[model samples]
Structure formats: structure tokens, C-alpha cells
Target: MFFDARKNHQRLIRRAVSAALASVLIPLAANPAQAASYIRVNLIGYQSTLSAEAYLMTTSSISGETFAIKNASGSTVATGNVSATSGKWGSYNVYPISFTLSTPGSYHISVSGTVSANSPPFSVNTTSNLYSQGVANALSFYQNERDGANYISSALRTAPGHLNDANATVYKTPAFDSNDNITSSLSATGATIDASGGWWDAGDYLKFVQTHSYVVALMLVGIRDFPAQMGASSNSDFTNEAKFGLDWLQKMWDDNSETLYYQVGIGTDFTNANYQSDHDIWRLPQADDTYGGSDSTYQYIRHRPVFVAGSAGSKISPNLAGRLAADFALCYYVFKNTDTSYANQCLRSAEHIFDLANTSPGTLLTVAPNDFYPETEWRDDMELGATELYFALQSGGLPSGLPHTDPSYYLQQAATWAHNYITGPNDGSDTLNLYDVSGLAHFDLYRAITLAGNPSGLAVTQSDLLSDIANQIQTSVSQSKDPFGTPWAWGSSDTVSHEAGLSIMAREYYSLTKTGSYATDARRWMANVLGANPWGLSFIVGDGSLFPYCMQHQVANIVGSTNGMSPILSGAVVEGPTNAASSGSLDGMVTCPPNGEDSYKAFNGSGAVYKDNVQSYSTDEPAIDLTATSFLMFSWQIAGAPATTP
Candidate 1:
């Protein structure tokens, strides 16, 4: 595996002896404590084409700290001194520095003083493909998240689970206590649907369409928007991964009956033991089939329950219907040329699902235990769903399965929804994420109009869409006053990824007008997650030297690594940080926080705390929704660069 090879190479790479740049040495009254000096860098390394940058941070501020770049052979390639302080973030004075490394070799930046500072080892890549291995690892994460049989061996997966989903019994949505758990046995709808495959929503086995729809839309969106990098033409693995998601989504939506099943399995509960929840158990997915508990609870665990948003053929919740419509429509756009039959199926489903969307939906149906994923925005989802539907229909001639149709109707619907998004209350509440996608929808809609002779017939104009995109990005930029140039929101790692995605959209969308200010924002946000943030740790597992070793993911802890290295969950991104961090333990979980302490607590400040421990799901849990945007971000970077070097 490339991930294993990369780790092995790190051990053999030659490191040049550190040589410091000459400095005046008229600095401090006393020696600055080396314990307080540090260099935070992008642990995954930098693109050779981009100026390699890092920050020199010190708790006890000192001037004239000489720095040097050492290559594999312990020879200094570049040297400099900390000229001035950039600014104070948190408790340290940060010195932002940039240098060039033209050679492709192992290298690191170090400072010269009574007690010198050295950064975690990083590589300078001259390879045409900088993030291919990262992209591969990201895909591996999806493989690890896979549910049902037909599983292939992956970096950390050998067995598949949730096979019961193949012919899973359908259950009516159940009432719940405050914690989003099933309170009683669900009434069977006298139906057993083929709800197999797709992904586990997070570390747990429970799945939901609220998050699944978002993942599928984003995956297909990446393929549609950045085809070359995603290898849509040449690479089949990435396509298959997206198709894996599309297939599961199709099962969730019964096209012939206009039914949309929104969730599967149950979550946390204390009162319900007869039907024990997934969170109540700590084990692998394969163990679910034979799980034993008092009161014959394993049947519910074995034959997982599926829940629908509404009755069959009734107006589906706009959020699910809209996003599902977008997923199917995007499938049509992506597969139309290669597989006409499957593409036609996608188009048919897209049209039918979009038609079932309740445009005036209030208290939008998400998942049971409504607070878990309370989505308030639907117009953006409808806008994107309608836009992609329009794209599917604009393919000149309808496919064998598709009959004569007017594409303008969907386009009009897309425009109206876009207008509703702008005039709606949720406009600036969130950026590009599971709950919000207007940042992407508006950009694509703007491009579509611009490419079609600047369409003057839409309910919303190109100017309106572009302005919304700019405002969304600007709003995020203005609110990001933390150490890193990111908002550090709930699910902060995903926010970091989504912000980068938004930047990519802004960069390309505004390039047409040549005034786009998002030139380096994408790289900046990417850096925050890769490293270069307050903790000097990569949020992505297996991508860098320092990352979350004790992620809240049960699979990683129960069967994966403990030393923060390979055989560990590769490419899963942790929730970076939140205002209030948390932790928990299961009955049979491994003893993580091996040292019995949050090693990263010192760096936690600015109203957010991050813990690389199993307890802190708020900060270290890896979720499918969090990993989706990172894939988009990495793929777009590859598209901007060149061929992936896997």
C-alpha cells in the first residue's frame, strides 16, 4: 500500500545536519527557553510548486532566532532568521515564514539558539502528483466505511458487516426520548427493502440519509467539477466508490413508488435494552449479526430497521428529496457517456424524486432524534437538485429510458430556488457543509448561465448567484479570527475542508471576472487541517507525522493501531475542535489516552478545545460527512497540479 510505503520511506530518508543562518546575537537579556519555542508546519509536506510556508511560534518571545532548512543529507539548503513577529495568537507570538525547496527530498526547518527548535520531519515533493497518495488514502477511508457484503480488503479492513441490510426489513419511524434513540419496537411496514451497502454514517454502524445524501452529492460534484483530478475518464476505482454510494442511495429511494427511506439502525439509549442501540455496543460491524443481549435484542441489531421520511408516494421531505435528486441527477451527468442504461436510470429517478420534493417544507424531516442533524435549509438543496436535473436533461437527446422532456422547467425551478435561498433566512447561517451547499450551488449555477450566452431568462441572474458566493466566502473569512484562518466550528475539520472547497469554487467562479480574492484561501484552509494550526497536528489520520492517534472511532480503537501509525485508520479526518469538547467510554473499549492525559490540551484555547483521545468524539471522531469535503479539496488540488503519482 502507498500509505505503508510512504511510512517506510520516512525512516530511510537522509537528513542533512542542521546549519543555522548567521544572526546578530544581540537578542535577549537571558537565554530563551527552548521548551517554549516551536515550529508548526504542514506535517503532510507542501506542494513544491507552492511556496513552502510555516510558522515559528514561541511562548517566551525572542528576536533574531536564526532558522535553517536541512535536507536528507544533513546539509543546509536554505537559511533565514525570524525578522519580526507576525502577530500573537493565543499565547504565542507567531512568525510566519516562507521558503522554497526545489528538490524532492526529506527536509525540515529548524531554529538556532541556546536551545534550538526543530519541526516535525516533512518532505519537499518534486513529483508531478503531490496528493495522490492522500487521495488514495481518502478513498481507502470510504472502503473502511463500507457496509454490507462484497467488501474488499483495504488498508485497514478485511471483513464486511451489515449484510442483513441486503434484504433489510422496513420499520416505521419510532418515537424517541431526548437522546435520539428508539423507544419501542418499530411497526413493520410489511415491507423488506434492499437497503444494502452505502456507508456507516460515522464511527458507529447507524446510517442516515441526511448525511448520506450530502456525501453522495459531494462525491459526484467533485467528479463533475474536477473530472481530470478525480480520474473520471481513466480511473475506475474512484468512479466505483461514488457508484457504491449512488447504489445505496437508490435502495433508500424506491423510485417506482416514490418512497425515500431516510435512516437505518438506532443510536444511543439507556432505557431501551430489548432493542439495544449501536452506541450501547462496542465492537465491529461483522459482530452485529450474532450480537447477544438480554431480551432477544440481537434481532434488531442483526436485522437492522429502516425508517422512511413519509408515507410512500407522499411528498418527500424537500431536504432529502432535493439532495437525493441532486445525487441521482449528478449520477446521470457523470455516467451518461460511459453507461447509457445506468445513466438513464439515474435520470428517471432524479426527475421523479425532484417532483416529490415538498418546496414549502417546514421542520424539515432529517433523522429520528431530530436534534442529531437538524437541517433548516432546503432551498439550497432544492436549487442544486434542480440544477443538476437540468444538466441531466440538457444532454441534447434523451436516452433510451428517457422520453421527450423540456429542460427549461428544471432550470426555472433551480433559479427560483436559488432566489429563495438568497431571500430566505438561512442564507448566511452556514457555508458549504452537510446542512448548507449554496456556496457550491450558486457557483455552478453562475457558470451554467455564463456558458449559455449569459442566460437572461432565469428567475435569478448570474450577478445574484455570484454575489451570494462572494458574500458566503467573505462572511466565513470575516468570522475566522482564530489562530488559523478557519472558523473552528462544530465538526471543525469538515469545516476546514468545506471552506477550502468553497475557496476552490470562488477561485474558478470569479476567475471569469478576474477579481476573485480566493487565490490562496484554499491552500490556507487545507494547511490548517494538514497541520499549520494551533496544535501543530494533522487532523487527517495516516497523512502526516503528528495526527490524532486516539480517534473516537471504535473500529480504529478496537482493531486498529494505538501508536498513531499504519494499520491504523488511514485518511479518516477527526472533528478538529469545538467550544465544548467531550469524551466517553464503552464497556469493552481499549484503554486509550494511554498516558491518562490529554496531551493536546495546552494548545486548546480561543474558545475551542481539541483532544486526540477516544473519549472526545466532539474533537476526534471521524465521520463520513467530515471526510467528503477533504476528498473534494484534495482532488481539486490535484486537478490544479497534474497527474496523480500513486
Candidate 2:
């Protein structure tokens, strides 16, 4: 290879020549003499960049000096003066200069100079390792969590069951009408649970949080909770009736994993992100600009958001706490259920979120009522609020010194609330463990659902409770009748949220005891949602896609149907807007097909569309009953073209 001149070489030659000439000039071809040069280099680290200094020096005086610096690849990066001061007789010279090296990389220094016409050439090599030990240590900690065995294995058992029990006053009792609307037919079991027409219906809200937790767990663990066999076998298999309804769970996990990282750089929000169709429903064709709108009344709903450090806008909002709470609980559950390898991964994910929350400038703690509204209350948000920070701390091995109290106490409190609010009031008995919401009900249910009969923690005991709940849920479903007198019909009213709660009830009922009725109701609920049109062609994607405009209703119907079913082998249909307001179809005749409204837009364009669209690929989430119906070809027609084939 051709050689490029270095800074030290030129400097040595200049200085050595000057000094040697002062005494005598060697013959044109005199033997080369040996000389040594000392070079000093300094490193500087800045918040955004770095700098370094290098120079060459020789024992004997030289005429002039030239020096060049090179990076690790030996490329001539720069050449500059070797001396800051010059000697009167040119016997000694010094060059001091500083340069920058912003990114992390290695570099080398080469020096060249001449003492006389025939001065000897001397060289020494220096290398730079740009990354600091502290940064490296932190990065290593992150990597350990990513690849460690404990990290991979721990994501199976840490979801929360009773998150919003304290806020139950807002949940209106179920009521539905004859038209399968929210007014007359809505029962805890028969109708959709979130018929109140609120942005966050109780049932839909529960499903969203549960789904969020499930998705977060998968994101942190980087693996599936159920065995491969139990994963989505077909589209309809994603229905809730299946014992292991965790098919779409993986896709949801991937969506979260990809988005959270992107959020770190570009920031988080339903809007203003490069979200793909599956990643975000906010930007979908069915979406609208309702994000900052008021609830039902014209008055503006509060809007607050939790933000990472360096976020440009207000940093006081605890808006992201609910979302974070869901994520942390999922992370904990996944870490607990999976192999040990997931522990470190869980820690890493939690740590990054925590760091962002803690180091963020102007951090505050507490979540106001309007934080969820994001309209009027957006300005009053706090930081380090409940759910996000509290559960996040617990996920990372329950770090001590929490502000409010110990995790055990919180868990007990959660359990007590769950019993008092849900099981106690409804069942007319206080026999259940009412003091274990965080650690027992939410936590235990998460574990039991994923374990698929594996015994661990409270799983074995919870199975029995699940069976009883399933029986009651079925009874409720069977007793459900519309005020207008319709039988065997679902959703006369808009209680979509109840679908999820019921699924959980049914799951608990069957999972704990393996009771057939518990599973039967679960199956019935899923079947009702799928309807005669079991595939996207007629059901969720096309005519019936926008069939039910309630998001909470949709979420409830679809939440737990991801595996081990047969009817929905293809997957859930994509619910879009429809022309339900009109009585005519494309032909505009009395015989025209019903012009369904876009289901995606009906719930005022909540992010529910994102979940419905991506549920098929989610590993832990269940596939819709429509898709599962295909797998159960023995019972239902494959084409889903109005019965008879089976």
C-alpha cells in the first residue's frame, strides 16, 4: 500500500533538519540517525460530543515540524503543527492543538519529523477507545437484560386483574334494548358492558388495560407465553372460548416493542408518529380528529400526558400512568411465567421507562381526574403517578423504599378492593380474598390464564374460583332478554366493555375448575360476536365489519379469542365505518344490504381500531370468533356464507 505522510514525520523532519543544519549538514546519503519523540494526547467528553489533543516531540532539535493524526483504520485524518512555541535557534519546538471526536469509535496517532537532511524517522502508535466506562457499564447492564436467561423466562405471570376498581362509580350498570342496543338488553352477561357511550367504558377500559398489560409483557419478554401448539392455529381459533386464547398476543407485543423504542426518539402519541397500519389506528382511514374533544357534553375534558425527559411541552401530567401501569404489570407477569432468561429483559425495559420518568426535567407526581380526558385537564397533569411508577417499581423485583407503602400492602389492598367491588357486591358474599387486588386477583388471574393449567403461585386455587364465575356468567348470558322481547340475541344495547369482564369471568371459571359451562359461556359470547358471517369477507371486514360501532363492545367481543378455536381460522375482521343511518345499501333499494357504519370510527375513533386490525398477529391475544369459526368447520361453514354447509 502507498504510504501517506504523518504529522509527526513532517514535524520531526522540519525540526531535526533545522537543528542539524545549525551544526553541520550530513552528506546527501548519510546514514539515518535514530531519535525519539514524545507525543501528548488529551481526551474531552461533552454532553453532545468529545474532543482530543495529540502532538509529537523529539529529544534532538529539528528544523521544522509536520504531524498528521489518523483514526483506527490508519487513514490520514488530520495534520497540524507539533509545537506551540518556537526556539530562537530552532533547537526545540512545541505544537498544541485540540480536535473533536463526537461519536464512539477508535483512532490512532502517527508522528513523523526530520532532525536533519538525513535525520532518522521514528514512530510510536497510540490508540483511542472512545466510549467511556460509565456509558459502557450502563449499556452492558441493558444488554444483559436483553439476552440473559432469567430475562427471557420471566414474562408469563404478572398481569393485573383489578386495576380500576377504585373508579367504579363511573361504570353504569348494563342495560340494553330490543334492537340489540345498550338500552334494554344489556346485562352483565348478555349485553355489551360499556353501553354508557363514554370514551372509556368500564368493560372496554378493562379490556384495554388488560390487553395493554398483556402486550407490554410480551414486549419486555421477547417471547410468547403459551406453547407453540396453543398459539393461533387459525383465524377463528383466536376466539375467547379456547382454553389458551393468546394468539394475537404476539403481534400486539411486537407492535409495542417497535413503538416504545421509536417513542424514545420521536416521542409518543396517537398522532404525529410514523405508525404503520397495524401499529396505529389513529391515522387509519376510519380515524377522525376527536383526540382533544370533550366527553359527551360540550365542556372540554381534561388532557394531560406523562412525558420523558427533555420533552418540549408540559411535563407535569401523569397521563401515561395508566398505560405504564398496564405495561409494567404485563412485564412482571411475563417475567414470572416464562423461562428465567426474561428477568433481565424485564428489568431493562422497566429501567429505561423509569429513567425517562425520573430524569425528565420538571417531573411531578400525581394524576388528576382530567388527565385521562386530555382536553381541558391536559395542563394539570402530574408525574410519577400511580400505576406507572408504582407498578413499574414492583416489576423490577419490587425495589424497596417506595414512596407510599410496601408492594405487599398494595397487593393486599388491590385484592380487597376486587372482592368488595366485583365479587362481593355481585355475589352477596365476602368469602373471597378481598385484600389482594394487585398481588392476588390481578396478579393471580394473569398467571392462571397464561399457565394453561401449570401449577404455580395462586394458579391452582384460582382455577376453582374461575369455574364458579364461569357458571354465573353463563347464567347471566342465558337470562339476558331484550325489553322488546328478543331471545338468543346479543348486544341490543352498547355494553361492549362487559364482553372483556365476562371473558375474564369465564376464563377464571373454566381455568380454575375446567367446568364445561364456564367454557360454554365463553364460547357463546365469542360466537355471538362472530355471528353468521365468520370471516372478513362478510363479517368484520366488509358489510358487518362496522356492524357494532361501540369500541368497548367490540373490544369485549374480541379480547380473549386468540387460540384453540375452530370457527375463526382466518382471523378477526377489520371493523370500519358503515352507513347505518341509511336504510338502503349500494343499490339504494328496499332489498339492498344494510350499509353498516365504520365500527372503527363509531367509538369516536379511539385507538381500538389498532387493536382490532392487529389482533390476528398478536401472540398472546386471541383471534376473533369469526376467524376461529373456520377451524371449527365441523360445526360451521367455512365460507361463512349464511349457514347450511356444515
Top TM-score hit: 1
Candidate 1 colliding pairs: 14-72, 15-72, 15-74, 16-71, 16-72, 16-73, 16-74, 16-75, 17-74, 583-615
| lDDT tens digits, residue span 1-646, model 1 | 0000011000000001111210111122235434465677877777775665687767767777778999878899999776577666667677776787777878888786733567777887842355767777777888889888867676556788888788888878888776455577578988888887888887778888888888888888777766665655634247888899888888888878878898888674535555567767778788887678334766778778888777878998888888988898889888888887787888888888888888777788988767667678889999999888777777654765443277777778889999999999878766777778887778667656654556677889988887887777777666665545554342233444455556465554545466644656666667777878767777888777777777777778877766664577788876666655565567767767565566666666656677667766666677788787777777766665323110
lDDT of each: 0.71, 0.25
Instruction: State TM-scores per candidate.
Output: 0.89, 0.31
Compose the digit string of candidate 2's lDDT tens values, residues 141-257.
121111101121112112222221211212212222322122321112111111111111111111122222322332221212221111233222211221111211221122223
Name the 10 consecutive residues with the lowest summed lDDT in model 1.
1-10
Candidate 2, residue 252: Cα displacement in angstroms equals: 17
